[model samples]
Target chain A: MIELSDVHKSFGSKDVLRGVNLTLPKGESMVIIGGSGTGKSVLLKCVLGLIQPDTGSIAVDGQDVTRLRQGSSERDAFLARFGMLFQGGALFDSLPVWQNVAFRLLRGSLKRPKSEAREVAIEKLRRVGLTPDVADLFPAELSGGMQKRVGLARAIAAEPEIIFFDEPTTGLDPIMSGVINELIREIVVEMGATAMTITHDMSSVRAIADDVAMLHGGVIQWSGPVKDMDASGDPYVTQFISGSADGPIETVR
Target chain B: MSFLATIGRTVLGFLAAIGSVTLFAMETVSHLFRPPYYPREFGHALLQIGYFSLPVVGLTTIFTGGALALQIYAGGARFSAEAVVPQIVAIGMVRELGPVLVGLMIAARVTSSIAAEIATMKVTEQIDALTTLSTNPMKYLTLPRVLAATLVMPVLVGVGDVIGIMGGYLVGVERLGFNASTYLRNTVDFLEFLDIVTSLAKGAVFGFLAALMGCYFGMRSGRGAQGVGRATKGAVVAASVLILAANFILTELFFAA
Candidate 1:
């Protein structure tokens, strides 16, 4: 299980996340929805230790993560258990698709000969609906949708127990987004991985999420199963999902 | 505007910058010799730092050598000693032009390229992606470039010295009406091996300095396009200044006595 309690974070004088609390049960998919400038990404970064909260407790499996000291072998072991798909595909431009997919496996203790790793990479690519021949192409040559699929392949290549997706369907065409959403749903359910995704696409919520949370006023305004998401009744969740700009989510500028 | 205060501020800033760079350089050297060495990346750096650099460094050396020959011949004509052309050309190319020209060439070519490339990577989240994959950016990117340049530059300078001297030799023998044997003999007799050693060593030092400055500034560059541009400019200026400053200090250390 992943749990965040009273997380507070600010950038200089601007408060981005204020006393936000949330929990995702094991082997379930939780999606957080918010406006563009809302703290959804910041919350994810905080969980990944990319950013530190001012005062909060973020625990994975009940271990306090907000204050976890890093770089120890034990800490590295913990870090290795989680996989993430960045907003941008973020594949290494220098490497071909297969190499990018096998990046983690080709480093550290998991490293093997190039042929062995490439075979594993190709299998993972096939799982994400990419041809083995496409593995030789660089990231720059691939279209946006292809890159996103390659990124997903890389994320699940090592098959971590926990995974996080940031804007998984952004920049994708409707059909491609639906395909990616279905793939994400299938992967998480088949692997029984605890998953957290941050996005505004309600279609993604319906396709992949089991539970959903709404972030507003630097806090989680409401959360429930995807079945109850439409009737959340919280004005913020309603306005946000309905794509209304004339809501409580005001622009300070 | 007190002189001591001004001097103190400059010294303090310089020290801080050097201290930070020293720590980073140490980290780079450690990572270079450590396992998980990226041979593929090193080959790419070799292509970028050495192979692509040859034309620019060669062209600069040839033109500078020809121009130096003309200037020296003209000045020596006033003393009826224009025949000293070949000797001075040989020494100039071996002792100074080879090292300084190569240094400046790398500062302009390699430094800016590395800085711009790394800054782009930083802005586009590639470096962060490397970290997420558990690859150290310095180990993967910076060390290979620095190491390749450090190893390749001396050979480049040695080749440039021969080419620049050929430019001078051709000009002196054909245009200045000097006997081929006399000019060749003078060049051979006047140049010392230490001159060659000093220049080559300086070339290696300068190459390392240029690439180091590029990677350092690029990594430290602020976010956004404007930040990347500023970092690229800063890397070029810093690399150029450091190369010239190191040249003078090395000259003093090698021959001041």
Candidate 2:
């Protein structure tokens, strides 16, 4: 389980996160939806300890994350249980696809023998619908959708207990987006991992989210079960859901 | 008052840059003794910064040495002191041209490449991905390149010094009507043990600065293609300037007495 209390962050004078508070239970998929530049990514990075908050606390599995020092063994252990899929595929351009998937297994605490790691990578690739023939190919050789699949394979290869997806379907076609959303939903359910996703795509929100939280003005404006999202009654939620330019939420920056 | 304020801001900015680079170098050195070392990455960096750099280093030093020979011979002829060509070339190449030229060449070639590659990775979020996979970017990316350059630079300098002197030897005997044995004898006899040592030591310092600037700028790069371009440019410029500055300092330390 993850809990954030009054989390506040700012970049210079621009307040990105202003007293955000939320809870994500174990084995549940929660998708945070907000407009561009709304600090959705910042909020996710804060939880991952990639960005330090100015105030408040973020607890993952009942342990305070903000206090974890970088390069500490405790920090490594904390990160070992989590996986992240970036907006871009973010695959290592220099390494082959299989090596990328098996990256976690090839080193660090979760290391395995080379042959075993390669086999696991191939299996994960298969799980993500990539063939074994694609294993030796570099990420630059893959198309956008294929790269996303490769990224997904890498994310799940370690079978992390928690997974975060950042704008997973941002650049894919509608069909590919649907396929990826389906894959994410299935993977989260199959692993029973606590999943936190940030995206503005309504289709993706509906497809992947078990619970939907609307982030506006750096706070969770409204949050409820996925079924309640359509009828949440909050103006910001309604405006965002309907993709309206006119609403309580300002369109212009 | 406004002009003074602008000057003040510029001075502060320059100081801040120095402070940042100093901290970065210290952090890299700290990580050197830490566990979870990446030997494979180190090997790859060695091959990239050392082996792949040979052709360019060789070509640059050889031409400079040849040019230095011609110029020295021309100038000495005016003084009726043409016998000094071989000795002057030996001292010039060994003490200054070899290390300085090799350092600048590395700044142009290796520093620019490292900066561009790492900056692109930053823009694309590969560095963040490495962090997610429990790999420290400093350990995986910066340490290897910096360490390899620091160690291999002396070797490159040594090679450049020999090739450069050979360039002078060829010019002296084949073009300047000097006997081959006499030119070789004059070149070898003029060079001292301390000259060779200081030259290699200068090479080590230049190499460290060049790779350090590359990793420093690359890691701090801003967003997109413009960011990568700016980082690469900054890296080469900073590395070249630092190499020149360091060369002067090392020379003073070695020969100021």
Task: Quote the chain B TM-score of every prediction.
Answer: 0.94, 0.99
Mind giving the per-residue lDDT tens digits that candidate 1 earns over A1-253? 9999999999999999999999999999999998787889899989877678999899999888767664345545666787788888888887899999999888875678889989999999999999999999999999999998998998888888898899999999999999999999999999999999999999999999999998887999999999998888888888878888687777553
Model 2 lDDT on a 0 to 1 scale: 0.94
lDDT (Cα, 0-100) at B34 in candidate 2 = 95
Window of ten residues with lowest summed lDDT in model 2 chain A:
A244-253
- Candidate 2 lDDT score at position B209: 93
Model 1 complex DockQ against the native: 0.43
Which digits, one per residue and each the tens of the lDDT, describe model 2 over residues A136-172?
9999999999999999999999999999999999999
Candidate 2 deviant stretches above 4 angstroms: none
Positional deviation of B194 in candidate 2, in angstroms? 0.8
- The CAPRI class of candidate 2 is high
Question: What tens digits encode model 2's per-residue C-alpha lDDT throughout B14-88?
Answer: 999999999999999999999789999999989999999999888988888888889999999898988998899
What TM-score fits each model?
0.90, 0.99
- Scored by TM-score, the top model is 2
Q: Where does the lowest 10-residue lDDT sum fall in candidate 1 chain B?
A: B127-136
